[model samples]
Structures are given as C-alpha cells and as structure tokens.
Target: MFAPGQEQLSKEQIKAGEIQASQTVRSAVAGAIMLYLSPFAVDFVKKFL
Candidate 1:
C-alpha cells in the first residue's frame, strides 16, 4: 500500500500492531465468555447468600 512518498510501518511497528490486535480480540472473547457465564455466577452467589 505504500507508494513512493508514503510512510510505511517498520517491521517492529507492524508486529506491535498485530500483537495489540490479537490482545484486543482475546479480551473481547473473554468478555463475551464471562457474559455468557454470568448466570452461573449469580447462581453461585445465591447458593452461598
């Protein structure tokens, strides 16, 4: 995508971006999983309280 005068990301910068994206995806997945399991948490709390 880089043309003659356009700025391009260095290899380290590209890797860092990829890592950040991966972490973001993982965090989203974890949040969704927690949401899906939230009912169980409520149930567990009810059992003790």
Candidate 2:
C-alpha cells in the first residue's frame, strides 16, 4: 500500500539525515583534535624557537 514516490522521499530523507549527522560528528572530532593539539603546538614553538 505504499506509494512509490513516498517511499523514495522517505529514503532520501533518511539519507540526508545520515549525511548531516556525519558532518556534525566530523566537525566535533576536528574541533576536539584541534583543542588537544593546540597546547602541544604552543609548547613546541616556545621550546624550539
């Protein structure tokens, strides 16, 4: 009883949601990495130069 177009629309919505979630996670991970590295980088610069 499912309409053909409706099914496709739902699938597209699910795919979009997954893509958005992945992008958000990627951004959060990148921020965390930068936060973790910044102090080390500053110390390295001070120590070496």
Candidate closest to the true structure, highest TM-score: 1
After superposition, candidate 2 runs with Cα above 4 Å error: 1-9
On the 0 to 100 scale, the lDDT of residue 22 in model 2 is: 100
Q: How close is candidate 1 to the true structure, as a TM-score?
A: 0.80
lDDT of 1 by residue, 1-49 (tens): 6588888889999999999999999999999999999999999999999
Give one digit per residue, the lDDT tens place, for model 2 in 27-47.
999999999999999999999
Q: Clash number for every model?
A: 0, 0
Candidate 2 colliding pairs: none
What's each prediction's TM-score? 0.80, 0.72
Cα lDDT for residue 3, candidate 2: 69
Q: What overall lDDT goes with each candidate model?
A: 0.97, 0.91
Q: Residue 42 error for model 1, in Å? A: 0.1
Off by over 4 Å in 1: 2-4
